[model samples]
Target: MCRWLAYLGEPLRPSTIVLDANNSIVAQSLDSSLGAETVNGDGFGFGWYPTDAPAGTEPALFHSTEPAWNDQNLRELTRAILSPLFFTHVRAAAAPPIQQTNCHPFRYENWMFMHNGAIGGWHKVKRDLTLAIDPSLYPNVLGTTDSEVLFHLALTLGLADDPVAAVGRAIRTVESVGHEHDVQFPWQGTIAVSDGQRVWAFRYSSQGRTRSLFHSADVPTLREMYPDAERLRLFGDEAHLVVSEPLSEMPGVWVEVPESTAAILEPGGYRHEPFLAD
Candidate 1:
């Protein structure tokens, strides 16, 4: 269990959302109204593509085991950095220990991954899932989190070629393995994966109920709805964000992600498609 946000749009400081929003990621770290746990203080991490990088280049990363609010370095990095696409996550420590390596927004080449759910009865299913990962990728795992293992499974299943299919396969395997071990609820909660350009976010669970996730409308639309809200004035038209909860309380500002669906965001716009178990 964790809380995460993915931003894609015109360049802006990370703090604009992480620390400056009405109910910022920092605020959610302490009082996440919709999360299973209110305080995700185990650890935190962030990744952003450098402004100087070539169009297709990868991102730079900074991670720490300290709580987001308790780490001065995060604040320092937040103030000095800006990105059109970035991921920030606060950990609640599900199976994964409180360490820098176990933090979300785990990176591999140009790809970055994070999750807000746990593999049910992980201890029982861990071995089977670990063996499913190609030995080549198995060693890349630096932490014991179910989230990171899931990412490796996706990679082994060809995440770079087709993220949707790769993740779907991984989910299939997770459910398959869990059932063999007599574990229920093999999958749960929301997920986000990106290659520093496009983002794929999914909401799903075995029981047809998933975690709380929402995304903001375009900045122009939000501005019209909250004309007097100063916070809405900071972002450009390209600004878009997918969050675990509404960052602002204003009406018509955020739309909930449908259960059993995946949302994709890119510079062009947003798209939603049904997500089904494999």
Candidate 2:
């Protein structure tokens, strides 16, 4: 499993959540509370949209094969950058070699994606899924992990046109392939994606018990309820985060995403909907 986060709403310091939270992404690298691995040190990556970059400009990215907790460059970079929508992930290699390409938060044009669980029996089902991908997008499959293939499959199905529908179709296809291969519950994970505007997070598994996912309530709601608390000031007005696990122990601050659910986050706020199958 991996530990990841998708942030939207305000463009402040990237490190504000990556390094500032009580149990920050870096902290989770060594002490994740919900991940099966407990320690996610395989590698790490960060993607963020710059405030001044042009519309088609690609988000800035930094990745390393080293454990995130020990990556000096990661520390140097996150603290110095800022963006409205960003994603950070720490990987726990799932039977693959530890390499930069194996890291999460894979990118394609304006899209960035990350996953926290494995595709059951990926080895057995790899052939069918790989052959099912669109050849035009097949070159983008740089890694052997199920995650990269899944991203491209979503891209193939129509992620850019309609993210929710595209992903739903992609997953359904994955399930069909999985069932044919006799790989029960072939899908497992919490997924997060953003195009530098609206961020979408999903919690789903072929089985009912999926990986853990949570999102913070709106900042205004918290500030209104806490009045004079100085802690509220730590997060900017539009600050919001959705993660594989709670970044802190702040009460009334986090809500667990229901199984087979999806959430969209933007400047307006978070909107959640059941992840119904198409």
Candidate 3:
């Protein structure tokens, strides 16, 4: 449905992955090889934590209804800013209207969230899901997309306490509500969330067949595998990325995240754990 990526590691310009890579996120916005829609031109969003900001500072965000490939400001901003952690998402609007509020990389305080899938039969269960959000947090819901609702739902269910469990609970809520409306496969998405420190990405769906998700291999390992590759020299050993699709065609560069799994990227490296497990 959409293409997105999350980066955590050394501080570097956002453009390195968003624009300068072989098949950058901007390129995916216009011609995604694996997305359900080839052109995700409805809108785009970028969020990043400033390298110099104090700990727990909120990440800055830039959103536009313009196509990612055609946005001049996006080009300039990504080039100028360097961040240790960031998120970029290009939207392919399904049933929602094309507007800035609906863009991805949705934020709440110091946290950022984005998604690359949809809730089946969203209209049938929209009311129930929205009403389930905690009233205190409900006021912060600024968009109509199921993605934003899912974020707030996670927050209400305790995203601040435990992201993995909160997200699991949120998806379960969506599945439960959708089942009441006869929508068989209610939840489908590869979601990424961060609290300005570590990133937690989940790949899951109610039907068991989920969207594509991958994380980059550790930099030291990549360096040893491809010693002569110039691109490999640019990143620090701590660099890691989790994306909807591989950013490059280099062999051994990206590893496919398993179905029903949560890939967590932290300072040292990354790891995978079963998500929504019984």
Candidate 4:
């Protein structure tokens, strides 16, 4: 398993969420309270859209095989960059080699993606699944992690056309292929994807017992609840975060995304919709 955080809303330094929160992404990397694995030390990656970059500009990426907590560069870089939307992932390699290419927060065009779980029986289904990716898109598949394959698989199925539907279709296909290989539980993960604007976070597994996933309470709601909390004041009302675990233990600050569902976060607000695998 892995841990990741997706942020959208105000233009702020990446370090604010990646490092400043009580149980920030950096903290989660070393001491994850809700992850299946306590320490996600394989590698880490960060992807962020430039605040001043022109429209359609792809997000910048920084990946390292070094552990998040042990990397001085990661700390220096996160504090220096500011972005309206960004993704940071601390990986726990299941079977893939711990190389920079296998880091999370994979990118394509103007989109960025990261995942926090695994594809069950990946070895049994790897060949078939890899062959299923559209050849035109397959060349872009640079890493060997099942997480990266899942991204391209979604792309082949039409992620650009419709994120939710494409990912659902991809998972459906993975399970179908898994069943053919006699794998009982074929899919298990929470996914976060962005196209330089809105973000879509998903919670699903073929068996209906997905990993832990949560999103911050709406900014206005958090404001009313904690009027004096200086941290809440730093963010604009539209600020939102979809994380593998609550960034902080503050009461009423986080809400668990229901099993088999998706949350779409855009400028004005966000909405939750059922995410079905079938």
Report the number of clashing residue pairs per model. 0, 0, 0, 0
> Which lDDT tens digits does candidate 4 get at residues 1-278?
89999999888988888988899888988998889999999999999998867767899999999889899998898889889999999998888999999998999999899998888999999999999999999999998999889999999999999999999999999999999999999999999998898899999998899999999888899889988999988898889999999988899989899999999999898899999934
Q: Determine the backbone clash count of candidate 3.
A: 0
Q: Model 2, 48: alpha-carbon shift in Å?
A: 1.0
Number of clashes found in candidate 4: 0
- Which regions of candidate 2 fall more than 4 Å away from where they truly are? none
Local distance difference test, candidate 3: 0.94
Displacement of the residue 178 alpha carbon in candidate 1, Å: 0.5
Q: Specify the highest-TM-score model's number.
A: 3
Tell me the whole-model lDDT of each prediction, alpha carbons only: 0.87, 0.85, 0.94, 0.92
lDDT of 1 by residue, 107-161 (tens): 8889989899889889999988998889988778998888999999999999999
TM-score of each: 0.96, 0.96, 0.99, 0.98
**Model 3 alpha-carbon drift over 4 Å, by segment:** none
Ranking by lDDT: 3, 4, 1, 2
Relative to the true structure, candidate 3 reaches a TM of: 0.99
lDDT score for candidate 4 against the true structure = 0.92
* Candidate number with the higher TM-score (3 or 4): 3
Off by over 4 Å in 4: none
Tell me the tens digit of each residue's lDDT in model 3 across 121-216.
Answer: 999999999999999989889989999999999999999999999999999999999999999999999999999999999999998889999999
Return the number of clashes found in candidate 1: 0
